[model samples]
Target: MFFKRGMLVTQAILLNMVQLLTVLLLAPLVKGWINRSNALFQSRRGPSVWQPYYDIFKLLRKDSVIPEQASWIFTFAPYIYFTVPLVVALLIPVLTTFPLFMAFMGDMLGGGFILSLGGFFLVLAALDTGSAFCGLGSSRARFVSFMAEPVLMLVFFTVSLVAQSTIPYIVNQAFAGPALILAPSHILVVLAFFLVVLAEIGRIPVDNPATHQEPSMIDEGRTMEHSGRHLGLLRWGADMKLFVLLTIWLNVLVTPWGLVGSAAPLAVALAITALLGKMAVAAFLIAFIEGCFAKLRLLRIAEYLGAAFVISLLAVITYTMGI
Candidate 1:
């Protein structure tokens, strides 16, 4: 029995490692695909889909520039931001429907808190430099976060009400049922969650990633003071955060159809293929939105998120009332 338990632990560890590497390696590719798709929608030839990988390699080979007045927080925030998503990757159902070794360490709420911890430090770092642009961007970012958090909580409430658990793997299993997947409350929650994702990831209708203008900058402005390897880490971390959120949205909140069910090598390979295919479809939809929609005026941002909150709240009400 002891030997059997040891082997189980070993297998879980190996699976966890696979999850980590998958997040790290594929994140850039996902970002690149989004950019390329957005460009295609505009009838322009964009950079190759592998461009993000090249950019990261170039940034790592350069040196980071430190602001004269910066403190330890500035140096520390990048590392924290870079590491939080990796921790989240372990907590979520990334590659499998079964919980891995570290999965029990944190449920969905705990993982959300960990992701917020990274953002909190990043806000501090933005303020640390005392740059007008960084401060502007950070304030806007915080305002957006302020608006989005309630929707996120409502989404969690709705999911917990439906699945009766905050654990991601269990949530996925619960969602695998057709009855639950097609429920009115589930559809409402998915719509709400997708809106929150765009706000969180600094995508269109919230912020324009393609625009670096200081006055209009939201997400990019917070990291303006960073350069070289530090910037690389921040950028890569953002990409990984996007990948992680989308993975959760697809594998847990949307459907767990493509996830590997057991520890078989062939199953894992097919699961990876299906996962990438799903990601590509998601990327195209995001690109379509970004291509067609303009960023909202800063003052109008709250209204946008408020819609998400209302949708999420309705999801909870509907679920509880058996609608």
Candidate 2:
């Protein structure tokens, strides 16, 4: 019996490792797809979908140029940023429905706190540089976070109300049924969460990732001083952050049907394929939205996230009312 238990533990560990690698590797590809799709919408030929991979490898080969006045936080933030998504990956149901090793270590709320901790480090590092733009970006980011936190709290509260738990795996399972999938509360929460994702990831209508105009840089500004491997790590970490957030959006809140039930090789392969398809569809939708909408003025961002918070609040109310 002990030997059998050891084998099970080994299998879980292997599956967890596979899931972590999947997030780290495939993240850039998803970002590339979004960029390519966005370019196609604008009638311009964009960089290849493999461009992010090339960029990361090239940056990794170079040397990082750190600011002289910068403290240890400047050099430390990148590692934390890069590792945050991987930590969250182990907590979420990525390719499989079955919980892998460390799967129960933390739930969605814990994952959110971990993500926030990484962002906090980056913000501190940005402030530490003493650059005006970095300071501006850090302040703006903090303001956005200030507004986003309430919506996120509401989102979690509503999900917990529906699922009776904050655990992502359990939440996914709860939403898999047809009734919950079609519930009004679920729809509202999804919309709210998507808005929060857009704002958090520095996407269109919040801040433009492609723009380096300085005045309008929220996310980019925080990392502008980073070079070489440090920049590569931050860039890769951003992609992984996007990937993991989308996975939660897709697998937990949107379409929870494609997750594999076991660790079988074929099952994992099929699950990955299904994930790619979902991500492609998501990329196209995001591109279309970005094309249709202009970036909101910084002042208007509060209202933008405020709407999300309100929607999530209404969701909670409706759920309690059995709607």
TM-score of every candidate: 0.98, 0.98
* Residue 51's lDDT in candidate 1: 98
**lDDT score of residue 252 within candidate 1:** 93
Q: What's the C-alpha lDDT at position 224 in model 1? A: 97
| Prediction 2 TM-score vs. true | 0.98
C-alpha RMSD values across all candidates:
1.0, 0.8
Q: Which ten residues in a row have the lowest lDDT in candidate 2?
A: 95-104
Q: Lowest summed-lDDT stretch of 10 residues in model 1?
A: 263-272
Evaluate model 2: give its lDDT: 0.92
For residue 91, model 1's alpha carbon misses the true position, in angstroms, by 0.9
Model 1: clashing residue pairs?
Answer: none
Off by over 4 Å in 1: none
RMSD of 2: 0.8
